[model samples]
Target: MKYIWIYAVIPVVYSIMFFSVRGGFLKSAHMLNIRFLSGLSIDDGSVRTALLVIFAANIAAAVITVTGHLGSTAEDGYLLREDYNGQTYTQNLELSISGEERPIEIEVAPRSYSETEKEAILSRAAMKIESIILEGQSAGHINQDLKLISSYEEMPIVISWVTDRPDILDWDGKICRGIPEEGTDVVLTASLEWGELEKEVTIPLTIFPKELTGDEALREKVNEAVSSSNNSEDEKLILPDKIDGKNVVWHSAGSGQGLIVLFAGLLFAALFMFSRIQNRDIQEAKRQEALLYDYPHLVNKLVLLLNAGMSMRAAFEKTAHDYRISLKNGGPKREGFDEIL
Candidate 1:
């Protein structure tokens, strides 16, 4: 029973000291929430109730923060499928031109082939290459406009052609730019050199005069406007009335300082709580020692009274009575005697 009381009393006393210290600090700076924090300082059942509520709230908040952090990390692609699997995989992740653009699909498969079969596969791949379109031109008219088609691939392609009419359609190393006087079929051979392997493709081209329609002209204008808008310095500013005006600019205000301050406050609170809880056993032991120091004197008085021939109940009652009188008259009170009484 005494051990149980000590266990209960230590926490009760710790709670009082914790709340009083916190309340005094907060009160000094006029930041204390009286309605909430003040209840813990009061010597009543409400203090225990408040502690229970605070503990439950902190646990709930911690759970929510952890869950949210995990969810956001997964959504942002920080978590990968390969993390949980033992198989290796590769992905070509690229940003889309527009949000609605579909991702490019690549397939990987294993096959055993002879050298002849591999050469046949390369030959088939090279024959599949069709006519190459210049950067700004549409696919319909290749002959009317002599546009220089530059190499857009990461590795430059070597172009060589044997045309029936070399004078009409000519090829420079960089670009194919020549106006054909009449409509004629021309064969163009382009080769890509990668390391020691060379892949060649033949392209059939027919050039004719192209007439621009009203809709096509309007489309070209719109394309030009979009391109100019993208390249403009004021692209971030938005002005709906002006077609070339920019969208609104957004600047990020980072939370580094705020996070640092918040973490520091949490660290301080944790340290304070740990310090108070850690010293609880020491404080309880000290209190017990003080009470035990008075035990010898208390036992001696009880022995004297017992030797005086008084009854056991009378002697016990008289001992308690004397302690009460002393306490009431401002005399020193011994904790050991008080417990016995």
Candidate 2:
């Protein structure tokens, strides 16, 4: 009922604007020189167009707010039954015990399945769990982090994972420190539980060391030597002088030579392009000025030939021939004369 008031404001505002404009409220707008309203009059089409736009925009905003606020309802701190589908959606919810507000994502699934169907889901899930843990590696080459899931969201079962080698791979599937150069074998066990039934799935995996490049290996050695040199109780701090039977040299990394060279190249290219464009524009302007300067003389010659009883075509031909003869005698080159010929 409260949300319905949002729609009522749209009609009331539209009616007021219609009556005010149709009456003479905007008649003084032109005399007052108002920015937008000065161009609108009582009988103008713009008056009707502006009213319709305001009416539409208000109705749209009201509809969006009402639907967004009242889409899902709750009673007594629990969600309404009709709002839950099988897919996920979010709702603003408050916890009764903690008095805390939070937006919770909810997904509801059916719990009633026959015993035969439940067994089939678990059987397929066990086979699927192997690929999920491997995460894209083959069974013989596991070097990165594993994807150990606590629950499978697709099915109804809950899973609890365990590993045999805690040093190589922990319970959270993180690859631990100091992995052996050669591979190590580990067994992962998943305990699957659903309502009252339980099942176990075992996956055997071989874990290998991560491959590192030359630079990465050198940095790792330097880091190990620096970490060993730290003594908290000493007065003076010590830095590592050697790492892995090789000498260590430390320098500050603030050299700007590379950036200086890049900027110099860019500046040179921009200046070269600017000079080329300026030269081309100067040549174009000179050609246009030359043509404009020679236009009056050409027009006078054509008028004199036409007044002496020559036909229009003969006058044009005689003008072109005179321009060519002047060019042969040492007259200045004019673009207009060349175009006439």
Candidate 3:
């Protein structure tokens, strides 16, 4: 009953508070509370919950004293998709933050996949990226990439595909844009191994650019795609908890909010554990009191056995065997055995 109240009340109250803020319940964009909720997400779990509360409090406290000049989005900042060869690419191509208007374009194309190119692709997946690398063929100023890539078709049909090319993959298996075939969604691969590495791995990744909205969903999708290709790299390098062994290291977003959510979740779990311990103690105490009630019946049975042609020693031994068997099979243990000796 106590546990029922704790789990039910805690999440319910938190959920109402969180959602009310999410839906702009009592605040507007100009208000500090609304701004704080925008940076939060419920699905990120409890660490995010704790971190979110702290982050919001911090932001709101600062807003009480600081100025916020950031606007939503600009007119030149629109969404567009480009196609190269047969694959399709979508990007949030935007103009520079400066007074200039020329958009920084992202062209989708298939280049030869190389060891250096894999490293380059992974680097582009990072937050601050300068250039993107293509797999399969060499990258050119769009001209050279297309020219050299077209030759792969003319050479020979070494491998044939049934659907869209791998480069133009949608979120699931759907191909957004690609050279279409009979069915859909096909990636014909003929890979050449390099170095002494016994296994070769292929990873799929989508690139997310910084837009005025700061779309985390888009970034997560792109991250998933890029991670698919990174499986060949084996375990990642362990990030140290301390720098010079003085204090714990920290990450801004991943470790920051994620850690907070984890800790909050632990609090709820600890509360649950305490409840279980208290309940267990109550049960054990009740069980001991119950033993006192069942004792006199055992005494009456023993008295009958001794009076009838049975010896006291034999009666006691027989009763012990029955009690042991009952205990092993989850039956009740005999009462008053403590007083027999």
Q: Backbone collision count in every prediction?
A: 5, 0, 18
**Which ranges in model 1 have alpha carbons more than 4 Å from their true place?**
1-252
Runs of candidate 2 with Cα error greater than 4 angstroms are 1-111, 212-219, 227-237, 242-341
Of the two candidates 1 and 3, the one with more favorable lDDT, higher being better, is 1
* lDDT (Cα, tens digit) per residue for candidate 3, span 1-341: 12233444445445555554555534432253456655644443453476468656655644542332122223344333332234555333446457765666455454344666545443333311112224332212111121112113232212211213435443232324222333232232222222321222233333222122346444454455445445656677344443333455556565477788899999989999999999999987876776687677766767888888779888887767667777789986444554453
User: In model 3, which range of ten residues has the least summed lDDT?
Assistant: 141-150
What is candidate 1's CA lDDT for residue 321? 95
Using all chains and alpha carbons, the TM-scores for the candidates as numbered come to: 0.27, 0.38, 0.22
Quote the positional error of residue 178 for candidate 2 in Å: 2.4
Best by lDDT: 2
lDDT-based ranking: 2, 1, 3
For residue 240, model 3's alpha carbon misses the true position, in angstroms, by: 26
Q: Write the per-residue lDDT of candidate 1 for residues 1-341, one digit (tens) a residue.
A: 11233444445544553465445533422343445554434544455466656655655665675565555433374434332114454444433566664555333232334556546554554553443433444333453444334332322333333445455456641223234446556665656443344676655666554444788555555565556556467647332323335444345789699999999999999999999988997888877997789888887888899999988888888899999999999998687887867
Error of 3 at 306 (Å): 2.7
Summed over model 2, clashes come to 0
